[model samples]
Target: MLKDFKAFIMRGNVVDMAVGVVIGASFGGIVKSLVDDVLMPPIGLLLGRVDFSNLYLILREGTAPGPYAALAEAKKAGAVTLNLGLFANTVINFIIVALAIFLVVRAVNRLQAMQKSKEPEAAPSTRECPFCASTISIKAVRCPQCTSALAE
Candidate 1:
């Protein structure tokens, strides 16, 4: 059982899948940062100086006061808040990751198509006999019906 388990773990596809999962997780982090740090900030500034990360609704007021300045402050005071800003950022991260994956898949598909196009097609093997005018295999040394010698 242990040997079978080791054999399964050592299979090329399983190892490749594990590597892909790790790389995908790292790529997701990069994409999330790109969306939050690069894209959202500019778009948020254009809309207004409103910080998307702080946008939230307080379900229950914090112990300190009626108005909470930020989500972190509200959370620090043990307030039950609906964090819309973080959700927005998460949505942006998902969109960016999905688009990146789509582009990669598309490019891989195109490369595969190009490779298929580059492959040489098998030529037709049967040919007409020169002397007898009969269809015969190109590999045949002599015509079956006429006994005519086939060309090399």
Candidate 2:
């Protein structure tokens, strides 16, 4: 059982999957930062400095009364709030990551297709035997299936 488990873990697919998972996590982090830090800031600035992360709806009043400026402030006051901005940020992050993966897959598929098209095809070098109708090499002097001699 232990050897079988070791073989399973050492397989090409399993190793590739582990590498993919690690790279995917790293890519997710980069995309998250790009969305939150790079993209959101410009969008917020263009929209009159409206910070989307702070955009939320308070469902219940907390110890601190109405008029909460930021989502962090509302959370600090124990207010139950719907975080629409964070959700939007997450959506943007997902789109970026998905697009990146799609582009990579498209490129890999194109490369593999091109490689397949470039390979030379081998010509068939065999023919059917006159007596037995069995396939035999053009260089054969006798049919192996029927032991019949052939014309030169």
Candidate 1 has what TM-score?
A: 0.76
List candidate 2 segments past 4 Å from native: 125-152
Q: Relative to the unseen true structure, what is the C-alpha lDDT of residue 17 in candidate 2, on a scale of 0 to 100? A: 100
Whole-model Cα lDDT per candidate?
0.91, 0.94
Which number leads on lDDT? 2
Candidate 2 is scored at a TM of: 0.82
lDDT accuracy of residue 12 in candidate 1: 100
How much is 39 displaced in model 2, in angstroms? 0.8
Q: After superposition, how far is residue 73 of candidate 1 from its true place, in Å?
A: 1.2
Error of model 2, residue 33, in angstroms: 0.6
Best by TM-score: 2
Clashing pairs in 2: none
How close is every model to the real structure, measured as TM-score? 0.76, 0.82
lDDT of 2 at 76: 93
Clashes of each: 0, 0
Model 2 is weakest, by summed lDDT over 10 consecutive residues, at 61-70
